[model samples]
Target: MADVVIIGGGITGLLSAHYLAAEGAVVTLVERGECFREASWAGGGILAPMHPWRYADSINELVFESESLYPALCEQLQEKTGIDCELQVSGMLQLALAPEDEILARQWCERRSRVCEVLDQAQLQNLNILSTQFSHALLMPETQQIRNPRLGKALLAALQTNPAVTLHTQTEVNVIETEPLRVVTDHGVVSAGKVLVCAGAWTSRLIAEYSSLQIKPVKGEMLLLKAEPGLLPYMLMCHGRYMIPRADGHILVGSTQQDSGFDKTLNVETAQLLQQHAQDVVPALEGAPVVRHWSGLRPATNDELPFVGSLPDRPDIYVCGGHFRNGLAMGPASALRIARQIVAS
Candidate 1:
């Protein structure tokens, strides 16, 4: 029996295992599929909350804390695991395509007290401005991003080499029992003092009767395009659509949030629409070749906030899932918080 049994392999579960083992807990992680291959690897990796003032208080809290911690955390991961997560501080440009949206964005910035520069049409033209001109733009200079796949690879390698942590891939948890404080699996039973249900999109179905969290799978479709490095220099977001440029000249444009239950297949029509969004933002990307198209299920809750506390009836069983699109943005701090909660409990 390990000290902790975590049920999921996405960023949430893997990071939970990382923090727990770092704190000297015997941890075991079970994954239904490959580790770090879900929404964690599929995200844009922006450390800041998308539309900060529009998000719920829970996301805002984790977003701010994670933004402060990501720099040091990425540095340590690279030094220890020899994997460069490409944590870049390139900042973000939020577009207000409509007059009303620009007004709302300015008001939201004021309400949140976030550092932002309200740019006029001339100022917006000076930047790598979108093709179709809008009212103005909101410049958030402190916004940061990471190469999500690299970060996922780094975390997985760190766990694989850690002697204190045990990993099980292609493993499924059959049922969970409270009194015995153990999870029954097709592979075997895992007994632990604490069991965290960070199973991403599978949380609600897995623990529906055990907990009150109604987690649903929201499918997000994204596409990658090969462009010149300077084609789209910074991240551009307008009307919930975004394009992020990588150091190697590849830009990932995404995504469409569909209530598609557990389906991970990529739709070409949806991918084409995302590609069009990239082209609309940066006309140079119109020539960029299509590289890859993928989709990942974001675990969404009723309130769009993650259930991070222990269960009401079962103090030993905790939950840290349903982060929706902010999973990558809030992952690190969420893990640390869950670790402390478990240790203190």
Candidate 2:
């Protein structure tokens, strides 16, 4: 038996395996689909919590701490794997389309100095194409973005090269058998000293027979637009929607938050709505061709906080899912905390 068995090969599970193996623990990770192809790969890859002040103090603290860890993590990943995860520190611009929205944004900035900076109309105009749509904006200087798909592939490569880690892809874990500490999957049974479930949207269903944790699926759809450089330099947010720019001159416009329960299919109406929002924020994008459109399910909780630490009734079992929209942003730190908890116990 291995020291740890991580069920679900998304960012959380992969990171958990990385950390556990680094600590000299024998780790095995199983995934139902290709690693990181679900929500982790489908996300916009924004590293900042959207409006940090809107969340509880604990959530804000967790996000801020996680944001702080990205620099070192990115540097280490690139150095070790020789893969450029495209960690961009260009920052994020949250625009205000109306006076009331501007006032609310200003107040939000006042509470956190390091996370957000309230920008005037002139300052907002200087960022990029967003100047025409909004009179004011909040610039998150410390915020950053990563190429999630590339990061996922890099992680898989890293795990494969590590002798202490074993990765099983296209393997579905049906149920977790706790007495012997074994995970019953479609292929075979994996026995370990402990089990950590990081199964993203399928987390609740994975643990339902054993635990009663309430994890819901939140559907999000995004559109990718190919544009030239100088079209959009940074990320933009307005009214819960956002446009994220990539280094390759493509801007990702997203996303519609619906409670559609595990439906990953994209809808034409939502896609068009996102495209319209992108064009409204930057008219130049109206001509940008729609290169891709996709959807994923975000694991959300009743109170919008991720379930970290141990399972209530089972000591050998643990959970680290239900991150909602901040999975990519919070993956590293969440995995670190979960691993530490398991190791210490």
Candidate 3:
């Protein structure tokens, strides 16, 4: 039996395994599908929350802590795994704001002591890639992003090389039994001293009898466009959708939130709508070829803040999930906290 059994292999699970192993705990990480194929690989990897001021302080606390940890984390991952996660400080430009939004943004920046510069349409036009239709825009110079897929690869490689971690891919966990702290899976039952569920959308189903944890699967679709490097120097967000530019001339235009349960089927109409949104913001991308289109499910909680603690009655069973759209931004800190709790116990 392993010291810890993690029931998911997404960012949360992988990071938790990384931390627990560092604390001399033997971890068994199980994944239903290939690791990182879910929301962890599908996300845009924005280091900051979409709008830091819009969310509760709890959400901001985890995200900012993870943001601060990313620089050193990515460096260590690359040093160990020989894979660059492409972590970069690409600023974010927010457009199409209301009068009150501008004021709120400024106030939030002041309170947080973060950079928030307001620019008019003319000043935005000077950037060349953005459409000059919006009255003003907010420039957040400290925002950072990573190539999520690359980050997944790097983390997986690091764990695979670690002696304290055991990985099981394509392993479906049917139920979790707390009396003996064992996981019933397709292959066989694995006993553990402690179990941590970072299963994302499938978290509620696994521990349905243990607690009433409601984690809904929110579907999000994205389109990838190939463009010239430096064409768009920063990430752009308007309404709820955004375009994230990569260091390698690939731009990600995403996404739409729909209550689609666990179904991941792609919709042609949805893709067209996403393309239209992308072209509307950057006219230069009007003729850009959409190289790829994909969809993933984000796990949303009732209170919007992630559940990062143990179950109500089960001290041996813990959870670090329901991060919704901010999973990548919050994964590091959430996993670190949960691992520390398990180790101390």
Task: State each model's C-alpha RMSD to the native.
Answer: 1.7, 1.8, 0.9
Put down candidate 3 lDDT per residue, 1-345, tens digits, no spaces.
Answer: 999999999999999999999988999999999999999998989988888888888998898899998989999999999999999999999888777877888899999899998888798888887776777799999999999999999999999999999999999999998677899999899999999999998899887888898898999998999999889978999988899999989999999898989999999998898889988999998889989999999999888779998999888999999999999999899999999999999
Q: Tens digits of per-residue lDDT for model 1 on 192-255?
A: 7889998888887778767777999999888989977876656888878988888998888888
Top lDDT hit:
3
Winning model by TM-score: 3
C-alpha local distance difference test of each model: 0.84, 0.84, 0.91
Candidate 2 per-residue lDDT over residues 75-147, each given as its tens digit: 7788888888898887877776466665665676666666666788787666556637566667777678899
Pairs in steric clash, model 1 = none
Q: What residue pairs are clashing in model 3?
A: none
Badly placed stretches (over 4 Å) of model 3 are none
lDDT of 2 at 68: 85
